[model samples]
Target: MADEKIAKLVKRRSCMKSKLTVFGNYLHTLESCNELSSLQLLDLETRFNRFGSLYDDFDKLQCDIEMLSEEPDDEGEEREQFENQYYKLVAAARRLLGARPHQSSQLPDESVASCGDGRSGGFKSNCVRLPKINLPSFHGHYQNWLEFRDTYLSLIHLRSDIDNINKLHYLRASLKGSALLIIDNLDFKAENYEAAWNLLCSRYDNKRLLVNNHVHALFNVEHIKHESCSAIRHLIDVTNKNLRALSTLDQPTQYWDTLIIHMMAEKLDSVTHREWEEHRNTLNNPPSLEIFITFLSNKADLLETLQENKSKTKIHNKNSLDTIKNHYNQPTSTKYTQNTYLQYNTNKKHNNTYKKSLTCPMCNQNHFLFSCEAFRSLSIEERRQKAKDAKVCLNCLRPGHIETRCNLVPCKYCKKKHSTLLHMHEAETTVQPSLPVSNLDSFSSSTDVLDTTTPPIVLLSTALVRVVDSKGNVHTARVLLDNGSTANFVSEFLCES
Candidate 1:
């Protein structure tokens, strides 16, 4: 068995030597040809294939020799000779194949599988195939360097097919803008992929600068308007963008919830701010950024709903008020003049009665003797004149009393034992002639024939009146007399009694 193993190793070594010789001759022939034909190219391709196959065999043989050698002291010289020969042949093959020194060490998948100890020559069944990753493209921004480098190294670096030579292509393809300029300055003929990758790292993989830039960007996000849905969406998008950038910088984001929530909250309107405050108070634990964002979204939805409802309510109220005004103010055709006149009279009568009811001395309604909005709204001089005309006492400004026997203090200006306003009243009375009061009995007899064409004069006064009921009962009542009234009004309580 020992002799057979020795003969097998010798035969394999001789076969490899012969193949190398043939490959060398083919290379010589190709180099000598000025211009290659299709046949020559085909022969070159075949020679390359053969050379690859021989290299795989030599690799296997090298592994076998190391395993079979018991001690370096005994078999070291022979093993060294074989290893030198193998390396020389491999170098020559690489030169012929136009492969760099770094590329020669990488084994293709087909070669690795074929050399494995299995009849089917497949990969180890126990091997776990990693899922392929599609890395995001880098455009020379220093901000993106860390992510791009990490993803590229983790995914592409482990692949056997992407050797250092192929890595050059990938690195160039991945770069853009200033990154391309960086590679352009390097002597690519001398620099390998690792050297170029290290150069890129040295320039852009500054953890401190990157962290500062990302943090600054996060803090300096633009203020968002809170008018529309698009504005709110834009705010969320800007916040998410900054957070994602920070995360990419490998900064811990778990502690950034407060900062992010504050930044987002600053963009809210008054209503949304109140909503956030209420929601935040109800939380047992401090709210996260995501929870705060959800609150804003819900608040925005509610605000939109309320705005729509308020608009609808305003429109409905406006339409109802307009309808009521039109029904009350619009007149009918000329053919119904009598009906219109009668309606006018009825309305006038009702309005007069309403005015009288509202004009109690103590209440602030239309044109009362005291404490009314209309009276207060009048100018000072108008108020004074109105008080004098109504025979209201200047001290208390109440009716049914003259300035003398008022029992109030003397005037401060004239030092007379009268109300303060009595001086102004006397001056005005002196300037204008006073009308003499006609006898009530003579005036009533003269005005016995009432004129229907003219509006009756309204006289407001206090009078003693007799009230008679259907049962022939008579009662004396002190009443407010209004002469303009066409019909007598009896109280419902009195009629019921």
Candidate 2:
């Protein structure tokens, strides 16, 4: 019986060590797993719950310590005190476990070491922590997604430590299996985006790694800057030449121009080639991919009716407004199909599944998206109520208060509301009526204005004339305009007289 008791104690201690070993190991390995998707981390955690015993052992130890404290004997008193202190530790251990559950599947092969020593603020080789991301696929993915992704990828690739690299890769592989890290901010200035792309693409000697990372570049279809257009064209040309370069990227590697045109129709529903021409020609501006796609897609819908006219395959493939989207996402049988239509479908039905990639804040679905009708109505109604609650301006229709707080002032001449008196009274008609005749006596309309040809000769007196140089030096001379001699003379005052 004594041997059995000791063996049980030994076994519990070993279990405690193993659990701590597993938990600590995970935290250490996962610290660098920023590149992995949330789903992948969850999968790892599901597996770790099977072998980690830190929590249970801590609980058992605490119970034993508490039971000893209940005894009144002197020997039990010391044991009880130790047990009480140990119970506090057990409580702490339980709390920690509750907060960070086992998130690793198989302890990442023990080959990958944990990050930093716990003393140095880094956990020991065995320290591991489970990850927790509530909205894994599509949360807070505004314009900075690409910048974040590239920065993360760079950190992983540049890491010199092999163990760190392995941990990173394992985490990344798990993430890629579950999440599509769609880059949102690719619409930045072309130079900046290109710079980021160059950095990410630099380490790409192998093509498969690039695709596995799911590097998707999102670019705006419309840009007014000439330099930006030129850069885009150049990028599109490069993509054309190296289609393989984009084979692995999550976004379609089609020419940017083509993609822009497609996305333009998708985002705007009432566009036409003629309208596109007007925007391109008049504004020297291209429509955004979203807007262009929306318009073209609409046009395609109209053209489908005029089918006596032979339609291009691109036109025929345009999705109808009322078409069922159920099968629209299934992976195509071949790469050609995938390339032609860059969409995929899954069987799983998540409540807010549409929120998986691009989410609609209104209904929170993956398909209808944030711009969908259901969400748009909700947004509009909410905005209207908010404006009503805040007492929006009646005239300007702006939010955040009434017209009393408006900076607008009444214009004196036009009797219209303006921001300032200076803006109102600076009118030409106001200037004409306000001028004093005395102020005009010495100032000739012609002389008051600048004459670049020659500095105006200032008649100091009837005989003396002066001119100022560019350096503001005044040169005065005596001159006579004499009718008697029929000559003009430049001389000293005495000679002139």
Candidate 3:
């Protein structure tokens, strides 16, 4: 009798479970609908009322099965499964009917929805505490779908507290380009969220294509052209990312050490590769992938450290150019007296001290012999003797450089490069005593004496000529023309001018 009752109750439970699945399907169809028709609403209400009644019936069946069934464990699990499906369908139907349960609001400090393991009773907390959501974006790239999907599922899709319409909003916000076009025409309503989501998932959820793309990326990582920290870091990062992605695909990566090492080694620039080879040879055992990766990481660190130190060295030990510029950039009053004196002397022909090399021969003063009044008072013979005694340049009468290299103005006394005080004046020629005039007459008569009968002299006033020198300096010069004289002479005043 007990077995018979148990069998009958078990059969009823199975029928109820089947009925619940049909209702679940109906609710799902309703949930997917963008708008409910009047008839659909009527049917939904009627079904919910009936399903609402089944809750009690299901409770009663659980109690009866627990009491009558011999195998409590199996029946208990089946009963729980049926109850879970029953709750979801009921909750969904009621929600669609605009009758969400408010029992959750009654627990002020209620335990959080235990969805940490990714399985939940589809629990939603009133005023749910959410983490700071930083949404990920997509642009219809196969390479990006996996990351976007995983992140969106965690941050938005799996969040039960957000409604389908809001989740749809997040989805739309995150999408662009062809990815967005997949669902762009859909209406922004709760019913359309699932359809839009499904379209996106269906298009981008191709695992075979993803695997091929990631694998291609693994082999196609950009080659390192130089041994730099950033480039090495990029190479390491790209390889690790692709390898991790391959590992996620359940690819045989554990045995890929030698193959990956060979491929990655070929990608390294010559210097880095040579260093890596040296490191590899130093190891007694054939290095594993971890060891190889560690070598690259350490290399990158050392390179980065060296680059930083080089930059610091440049910053600390500045060049002399700026210092020299600053030194010259100062105003005359601010500079040392010697610099000012040199600059001032460049503009004017005369200098106060002339130079350190200049020293008067007679008094040993810091002036040229020509510039000294006491030296100027001496005769040319005395000045020449003084200059010879001092071993100075008799031309400029200055020390240290010869007459050929002298830079002073020419002597005003003679139009020569030597100092005026050292210039030698010429003596006027005598009448040759007229060859004792009578003898000259006899000699001139013998040679038919062509005007060797010296012409009678006449005193002529000094003639002045306006002369312009090569330096553009114009001078009023006294010109004396004498047929008897073989040379022309200019006065000291004209030479100085």
Candidate 4:
């Protein structure tokens, strides 16, 4: 039984060394392929798993050799040979596990030799832990399927560290909404993560369906008038999106390029289309889809800039015009000066006509009584005293005896014997005194004299005159000076004296 055990141990050690050699060669080949195909990735994963199994077998063999070395009956030479074989096995196992042959001087002696068992202290050599992969999230949308599939498979499907059993959990955690629902409905006991992934692909990864949807979306893009920049950006985004989808579907670049260019051209307005055609005509070679998209983007930017500049210029011009109009419409002081001069001339002419028919009482000159410089220069009280001494009737402002003897009638408004100038209240009614037909004709003729022998008329002007009696007594009498009187006559009492 001991020989058989030794034979089994030796055979297992040989197998582990041979497996390690094969694994090393395989790892070299994998590293050589700069980009690994899907088949190569699967092969690599299989090789890594095989290497792990071999490592477990090697660990058991090392334990068996250690057990064999403890047997007392074994010679020192035989024990040294077993130790040598065990060390060789350890070296082979380390190479298979991709561990560096050299030990760091910084690591302690126990840690460096820990791999003699199937562990590094508490850590197991058989359990190869790989870095956890963070899967890309998916919302089950058809558009996101392509990207999600690429990331999901790259991180999970080709990795050896993640077991098939734990794949379902990672897959579930990486999805949400409709995607989660699709996986949740699967029979948990029977269906694996692969089956769930297959279901997702069948539903969302229909290449022909995706291509058609993307093509339809690209064709239907429209440019908004006010949102030209956003519209152009959206157009480029959709174009690139569909192009990438087509490329993923293995559609020919030339075919999809022509199709996309035509679709984009159709979506453009007449002006932009004409401009695109002009640009195309100018190019010696037919413009590629990428070049066309770039040109359109540039054109959109230029249009937006031009529109902004034009709006600013229009506003500036409008403001300038308004300012000019305001400047033109404003009244000038020169116009006010001319108006003042015309008003002063008109008032002077009116004053000259008034002074032609009047005489100053103090100077007996052909000027207004108030226009006499001597009288005007006097104080208010002194002027009043001079007017009183000259027998100026204060009521009618005429040269005569005092106001009591003056024959001035009361105001027509108040019907009281007072000056109309003294009447304060607004007149409720007015009556024009009726003049005789003879007086009316005489006044109308312009050359006829005014009658003096009429009853005292309200608000009419009157004056006082000095008279001499037969006894040589001086008496004052009130008399009305009427321009309409044809002949003047004294009273009967005065005529008899």
Identify the leading candidate in terms of lDDT. 3
Q: Can you write out model 1's per-residue Cα lDDT over 390-474, one digit (the tens) per residue?
A: 5566665645445553455666756675444333322222222221243243345434553332324423455566888778899
Regions of candidate 2 where Cα sits further than 4 Å from its true position? 1-52, 56-155, 160-263, 266-497
Q: What is the lDDT of candidate 3?
A: 0.71
Instruction: Identify the candidate with maximal TM-score.
Output: 3
Alpha carbon deviation, residue 413, candidate 2 (Å)? 89
lDDT of 1 at 363: 52
Per candidate, the number of residue pairs that clash is: 0, 50, 1, 8
Worst 10 residues of 1 by lDDT: 426-435
Query: How would you order the candidates by TM-score, starting with the best?
Result: 3, 4, 1, 2
Model 1 misplaced stretches (Cα beyond 4 Å): 1-135, 189-191, 227-252, 297-497
Give the lowest summed-lDDT range of ten residues in model 2: 419-428
Clashes of 4: 8
lDDT of 1: 0.60
Mark the 10 consecutive residues where model 4 has the least summed lDDT: 102-111
Against the reference, the lDDT scores of all candidates come to 0.60, 0.40, 0.71, 0.62
Superposed Cα deviation of residue 406, candidate 3 (Å):
27
lDDT of 4 by residue, 1-497 (tens): 77888877877777766666666566666556556565654454345444545656666666677677556455344445545654465444344333332222111111122332322322234543444445689997777788888888876666554576666776777889888888788765424778998888888889888888776777678754443656677788877887787788887866556667888887776777788899899989867887998998898798789879989999999898668656666466446645676767755654574455466777887764555777756654556666667555554445533455445575565656444333344322453444445444533444233322222343333566788888888887655454334566455544554
Question: Can you tell me which runs of candidate 4 are displaced by over 4 Å?
Answer: 1-134, 187-191, 269-271, 300-497
Candidate 2, 1-497: lDDT as tens digits: 65566557546655665655565565556555545454644544354444344455565764564444434375355445544544454443333333332322223334333333323432233345545322122132322333445444444434333344353343234233113232223333433444433433443333455444333332333432322223334444333333343542444654465554544333332334345566556644555544544544444455454543445544555654114344454445345455434422221222233234443333545433223464233333453443344343432233333444444344433544421111211212221132234533433443333322222432221344686657777776434232223233332322333
